[model samples]
Target: MYETFDDTLLSRLNEPVPRYTSYPTAPVWESTTPEVYERHLSQIAKRSNPLSLYVHIPFCKTMCLFCGCSVILNRRPENEETYVNYLCKEIELVSAAIGGRAPICQLHFGGGTPTKLTQDQLERIFFKIVSAFPLDAHAEIAMEIDPRTVVEDEGAKLKLLKKLGFTRVSFGVQDTNAWVQEAIKRRQSLEVTQKTFRLAQSLEFQGINLDLIYGLPFQTVATFRETVHAILEMRPDRIALFSYAKIPWLKPHQKAIKEETLPSTHEKFGMYLAARKLLLGAGYVAIGMDHFALPGDELVEAFKAKTLRRNFQGYTVLPADDLIGLGITSIGSVGDGYFQNVKELSTYYQLLDEGKLATFRGKILSPDDLLRQWVIQRLMCDFAVDKAQFQLKFGTSFDGYFHQERERLKPLIDLGLVSVDPVSVRATALGILFIRNISACFDRYFHKKEGPRQFSKAI
Candidate 1:
């Protein structure tokens, strides 16, 4: 069902590309102030669309060697308590800016490990947001769990979360192999992983997800196959098989990993293919580039219905018209603009103390940006672009407007990775594996002059 690849082809096609989580991408965002963000929120206040909220809990107990996200390592509970207080203040500032009591359809807690907070801290943040924004009756509440953090009182903690309206949770179990886990400095055993999964299942959470990484140090097809088989036994509602993005220049912590121990591109592809085959055989449907969901899952249904969306959090089924981000280093998208909070905790607290939002940088999408974002998001999510629909929406000829992009796609089409016709431009099953590169053709900001240091490889 897919094309075979030789080493030469694989090497040539393995160029770095943006994950396209955002259209213009974070690299192009310009410095801006809270004033600019407030202007955007003013515009949002006039619209009736429900908002999606993202809270970045940046505190973690320890550093995972392979992690590239923004996080702070603190052993003190007081630091977390202080951060939670500031988080609530920021929420109040944003709600006041939006004229108060904006409706919310989805709320996601992410970061270094949201569960790292004490139960009191967690409840405070949750109630503060719900009080500021009236949560819809059908809204989704979710968080990221670092299984080890909850191993002490797993059942009680999970039950507490469920009681507080947490319907979905994702556990970070990067790999189950002992050697690989040791190499990554995350040493949870298969038994612990299984116990955590069973605990969430027994808690009757509506959705449970596990995260896995391929191409890490010392991974082989046989080894990853064993991990995948072990994961299959749990049968989570969703699985995220991410490629190990080794950009040491961007994240210096990654340099701790030995280069020679990491799998080569060809070997990495082998591991991915083996794992994907097993997932498909076990009745999972691939959603977007790195996510897979069971057939009846909302993600699979969204993919089938062409309503799937991609955000900074990766693939998602709930597409909110506006997303409001709170806490340090959080990013938000309102209308045609995107904004981010200050990355430093001190600065975040200083701004909140001044009764201001901590927006540090942002980008207001130009008309060209909006159009290109639409095309790029469609290709990333649906794996195809309907030429007729583009014309209808943008009032232009897709062929004429994207002449250069279509030319850029010619080589991929010739290799049977892409197919184009008068009606639509689509990626074949083989092309889906390289969807990031395919979608990159439409990105106006991605340039050879800028270099590819900012992004990871498509594979």
Candidate 2:
């Protein structure tokens, strides 16, 4: 077993920590039926609040060996068209459930590669969403892009995306090292990434974010530093640095990588520290666990103003509200409850063909679930929890419910990972590195089933 926070922190951090993207994470989603999801929409309608929509496009041209996300590869073009058609149907079904259009404050497209679809597919999907919902005039629309697959015709695609109201783009650039790229089967060249950024700049997207990863196979501190320097040169509005999660059993394709080639736990920590130092020195502000943005970036500003929030898609400046997820394996949150779509493409398609919503599973937040979620979200986003705020929002004394958790965390406090006061529990600098473990103390599902260690490391 691990001992000592410094000696054991790195290993413990890597020991299947929840992303804390959602409390009682997706693994515990069990009652999200289609009817239940419709009820969630109805609840949102009654609340009459601006909503956030998340569209999951799970198709990709090729699978990166290191990827652990829900994605389908080597799919026919017709499969994409079929998925889009079903997505349109889902929009109509959700719109009808809400009675009329509800204002959307944010819309984000994430995927195996959201840009894998042709221009026409994107247009059809976005147009359908716009027609079915009342998108706020200042709403932020964003998409994730795979630079390797983007074409010269991207100019036209950008024009259409802008016209359709997309204001931000995040491109994946895990590592610039050719050997690391080859090991992960991502194979993206630095030149290609540069070209993509230049093209995006020409198109004048409101914001550009570069997604970089550390701890990939064959990634050294020197190589990663060079990659960061190159990225700084690009001057993206935001950057998200992620630690590579190596889980061969959960994601069997990861077995393609030779385990010996990966960086050691200590080495990975060094890489993280080095990259953070370089970025901070270059005038970027660290936001939450793994994101950084320039001083003027909305995310950085949000953090300073205490408006940062944690969501299914990592960190966001957008406020928490109803989140409607469309497409296979997507999850939605309406504040009142949570719902998830069918994971298997066949199941998703079958329901759509039958004119039925394709929800397969879900969970309604019991009061306990909601309380724990609030605690976890605060810890994840703010590195602390205000006891008074907890009581004010949940209408229950924090001491009454979490008295045992306070006892359980005594050891962490002794280890200097956290400091507890009369009003709040704050994570120390050391605790920030292991925030997930601290947050896990409040997770209802942590002890239910050990299951598979399929998630990413905390560091």
Candidate 3:
């Protein structure tokens, strides 16, 4: 079983670390032209496995002060209509670059608030996706929604979304406490969130995920415990409890929040521990970092079968590797490399209007990178890795290559957060609490560089 770190150890380990969404995180990406992405896609089209698609909808009615995602303050219908049309064009451009329709096994729509679009706007985009790609018969279609946006006509909108092929939906219910919500500027009542969830359940959605943030302005262990109890009462199929990254430095809007109002590190840790105990008591299996799923959930099954995967969207049950990102500030992977679209809407539109792909910069995976990525993903997903499997895949002695890194991890191993031997590296029960620190052991970038903060809190 995993164990907790002492206060001294916890304080020392709480620092910035990459989420490891990708091997070479976005910060390392360099300028990548449309032609390079085009060539990469051409190679990907020859692969046997199908692809995954990620559509970014960077629009929101009201900005949340704690958000770090690229987004526009959109409330106008005409602006949404215009963005929807461009999304279609971007899809077409990507479809062409791949030379034709490719098998897509997973499709996800992520954003500031994907539900902000009108039913008509959503329909138009769904039509484009239907026409552009050949989706596998059992493909996973997921979307992220804001609870405040669709309270007007819940059943009609959800029913329409179901008809359009959405099997999964996540509602952003960061906190149910009114003061906590007010502090973040995303003030949705608990009743509204329950209504949306109940509607989705009645429509028979395959899965429901409730998004919760633990570390935020004015959150206490007792209050968050109440929030967890309410969430458990709803019984969402999955839960993503994230630590709020107060990155006002990167996302300037976050500056509006008073730093003093945020919970202290010790208090925030208590919230996490309490929430985990309650969820486990409610019969949810913790899946990777910041995620939990009930038994029989695909995510839990994927973990058991060792088929789980990590991507820009966090943990995914689908094992599809090639992702085609469509829309502004979107990112995708092709032929072992990652490419990103421009973040600004004006630039994104300018490129797409000229019949160009909106790739900004990218990086191809190096052999060493691939090996390290596999090791990292394995540890992150499975909490352990077999040395034999490592050797079989990479044709190198795992210990021989990562000897220095293995040595560097001795402190964590001694602290009882992780156990490493000649055969395997495993995170104990409480060790999983500091899994990011364990995984960071294999990240070469952090070791190679000095004095730079490009990531969020490890907790």
Candidate 4:
């Protein structure tokens, strides 16, 4: 959505950059062990704010070809029973660590595919969550669904979810183009997506979000235009428009996707502009960097009030002080610490079976980490940071502390992407497109450009 898709600017700015979902990002996490994560969890038990729970469901039947999530394509369907048992054990141990009867305000089930589980498997896992933690009066539960797998049975599944207290559902609709689908091996049809959307709307769902990716193989401005039009017709409550991060070395499945088929930086940028223009025209308010919502959606209201918060999950309406992550390969945050479960399946299971917290790695935020995180979050969500308010919180002059980074903004400043002064720092509409690149100026962890980085291109 910047001023003419400038190839020169793309070349200059496109480099390895974190999505800034977290300052210090995932690559920097270190020196954390199960004992350390457990310590954080125990400490969080005394905090007054309620909890937000992240449950990872890492099972899937097949590959999406373009997925970057931690998932396994389990052919042995019966293994879900064993997986559910282990999840319950983990939840019980974690809940006990939090002193049980802890309050849960938000619950999100994310995965390779949370919906891939059978109805009984889903119920069993849900039962464990409710039994372990007491939810608030209006506790929100959400899950990500794969539209390609939903059928008439999904109607019943949607109804079941509502009965079980889930208020939200997000469907993965990466692209609607047949050729794009073929190139990606997802093969989801527009008709299936329409049916899924209709089913969810007909139920008691409070919100529905459709996930779209901009830089997938075989995706052109022309073909993606039709995809955008088709998505707008569905009129989802929110849209998560993401730029595809091709990290083939990290996600080996992506290695098969030839670079020749992927769109150029300019084309990818143009596709993003086209999609944003269409969504804005259709009355969707841009929520944050990549999310758009209707005027009445909570995200839109939160954005206007400057209360939007970002976590490992994209954008959140709730400013949860603590997030407890359960299940294998999940990440958790408590206070200034972040923890992750064992990535390997067998090891994760063995740890829980031993009645131990399975945290394998983590990092405790430093003073600078927290400060830069605040700056990054503010600039990312609102495209601006109030100099006076920042000083009030951090007890430092914004200009003085960040002067070095401000100097680094010479190119962006010259290109009219951002404007800064003693009073305020703000991004022009064009600048928001380059927000990650601009925010990188303040990221202390990013400069090393160390060993074989896995971050995606900034464009």
Candidate 5:
């Protein structure tokens, strides 16, 4: 049914796409004042629901050329301390707004690099959080760490993190090839990563995740394969193999990377296919998009049972609830709406010092937005959506609302990339590789002008 792999398959994959982290993704959020954020928080507290907390640490010791996250580079340690104080003030304001401590089921620290915080600062910030929020005894606290920044003495710090109630840790390891490392300006050695891995293991952290990128400057199939093999040997509970999103025009730093040196679309696809085969052979189950987990891992089991969820942090087994984001540039999902803090440090500090919420922009989802979000989230996580559930939740037939998507998917169905029945729509194995494109059909906001070009590739 398909023609040449080049024009038909590979070319199809090259289309610019959204990651579908959210339906009306963060880009759609509009500027909101501190008053609106406080009102939003009050509305959430009234619901008496449990929430997840996402704290952003936007400082990095050095910039990685391939990185697309919002971060400040090479800031002094004093800058970190200043950031922490404002964060504490913001936390206090949120706590007061909530009326009291609300129970939390999940807490995650994502970066620039969360580990850049000194132990004392880490303790102070976390202490305020624990005091302000009622954390479940089985709550999961996770943080992303850069192996290069973590020292041997920080072993005790890892222990302290556990004692402070962190349950999971993730580290970034783009590629093991020295040439690739040199090009990206992130030169973490195997030794440093190994040490961090072993230290986490010794401390008995509940889960460990290793992140690897497939397409980078100077990376060959062989070098990528070696990185995959090394990761398999290390045996992390989870692995995320992401394709490098090369958007040089958007991220000016990336322009330093010669485009000619980057992998071709086909080459990058080959690397993904090869690494996937190796991971499968080693007994890792593919859990939704880009994530692989061992059979015993919770994510793998969740995938099989169809209980997995996809969030801003990628595929997760955690339950969906309100998520409160802290620190600069962090976004939070509370109830049916979303809010984000001020992204710049100066704005973040000024608002907090005045004892106000630092919210700059946010979106309160309309009923249509919520319905579309449900459909898109299901498509992303399960690779399928139940038509009956769509009707039940939205009081509208999926056929009536998404007639265009139905028409669009007809070609994919004919090509055996998807299966459509009255009750459900599912992505075939081939379709899964292009899930971003498939999911985009449900995105209403995606068509609004063109979104920012800084985003990585959909594949």
Candidate 6:
């Protein structure tokens, strides 16, 4: 792919675009209340759709300069306990709203660091959730962890996670280079990362994922290759090779990272190509835009079968019809709407204290919104859209409906990144690298002239 890369294409495609984790991304969700959220929950109850749960554990001991997530830097154990209690309260409220006993097909705990919680804290939260919603027979339970958090305990925490029915664990190892790690303010040594990986391996976790970031400060092509090679040696069941999104204005802590220290656009492209080549050579299958998994992994199987799905939680093999997000700043997609909890801890507590569900913002998908969502999701996950299927499902001619979008895609088509025909619209192998750019074509809201850029570049 790089053999064809040039300054012209970079200049043309390297524009800010939404990741499309969801259509009408979070930035545009309207002000919403718990009452409206409850109405959405009632819709789910009426449909009796199985649901997935995403619990946000937003506490961290320290802030990493490269982080973009909503997190609280609190060391008080009491704070965590309080959050857990409120989280459980929110869960119970949701359960009652949905008429209780909704089956869960997938459950994931993401951070700040889910493992940052003490074992007791984790257990209490975990039991509260499972007790409210029974887990489906083949449900997938997973959590994200900072390796440094578990390395000191000699896998004690890992064992407890397994005991609590967590089938998967994702270890966050942004980079292996000491200099790069230092620049990012995340100093997990290669040795510590490996030890923690081996610990999870020994526990016989059903699926182990390793996350890496490219285009970070102090990263070079050679250094990033070394990082990729080191992670490949661990042979994680799944790998998420993510591009670093630099939005210092949105995440103030990112200011700690000097822009000059970051890799240039061209160098970042080179780093991705190098890492991707290595992963492919290792026989890992690319699942979606940024995820790779070994042949037997469920994600790979899903990708191959074209049953893969995406959401705020990224790609998943066991996605339920609805996703319920718990905890502050967490976002949920239920029925035809998306909703999120308040971002502040004080506000979160206040809402739950008032016996409310804590929903602060949300979007109700309109008919047009649903159509665009389908188109964007297919382009992102399947890298193509079957025009016939679209017509059959949406009761509209894909080309006729998206005539303007097709006109918008002409540039990508001419660049050999996309192709459209009577039957389908597809991305070439080269276009997968710019999937976000391709998906953005169908996004009616992605206007460069619309205030400040809310997303990162697509290169």
TM-score of 2: 0.95
Q: At residue 3, what lDDT does model 2 achieve?
A: 28
User: Which run of 10 residues does model 6 get worst, by summed lDDT?
Assistant: 445-454
For residue 339, give model 5's deviation from the true position in Å: 1.0
The runs of at least 3 residues in candidate 2 whose Cα sits more than 4 Å from the true structure, single-residue gaps closed, are: 1-9, 448-454
lDDT string for model 6 (315-357, tens) is 9877587999999999999989999999999999999999999
Error of 4 at 444 (Å): 0.3
Task: List candidate 6 stretches off by more than 4 Å.
Answer: 448-452
Q: How does model 5 fare in lDDT? A: 0.83
lDDT of 1: 0.90
How far is 23's C-alpha from truth in model 1 (Å)? 0.6
Q: Assess every candidate by TM-score.
A: 0.98, 0.95, 0.97, 0.97, 0.95, 0.98
Clashing residue pairs found in predicted model 3? 1-429, 2-428, 2-429, 2-430, 3-430, 32-361
Give lDDT tens digits, candidate 5, residues 379-405. Answer: 888899999988998889988888877
CA lDDT, every model vs. true structure: 0.90, 0.84, 0.87, 0.86, 0.83, 0.89
Which structure is stronger by lDDT: 1 or 4?
1
Off by over 4 Å in 5: 1-4, 152-154, 448-454
- Kindly report the root-mean-square deviation of model 3 from the true structure over all alpha carbons: 1.5
Name the 10 consecutive residues with the lowest summed lDDT in model 5.
1-10
Residue-wise C-alpha lDDT for candidate 2, range 75-107, written one tens digit per residue = 689988888888898888888888764588899
Candidate 4 — which pairs collide? none
Give the Cα error of residue 253 in candidate 5, in Å.
1.2
Between candidates 1 and 3, name the one with more favorable lDDT. Answer: 1
* Model 4's TM-score against the true structure: 0.97
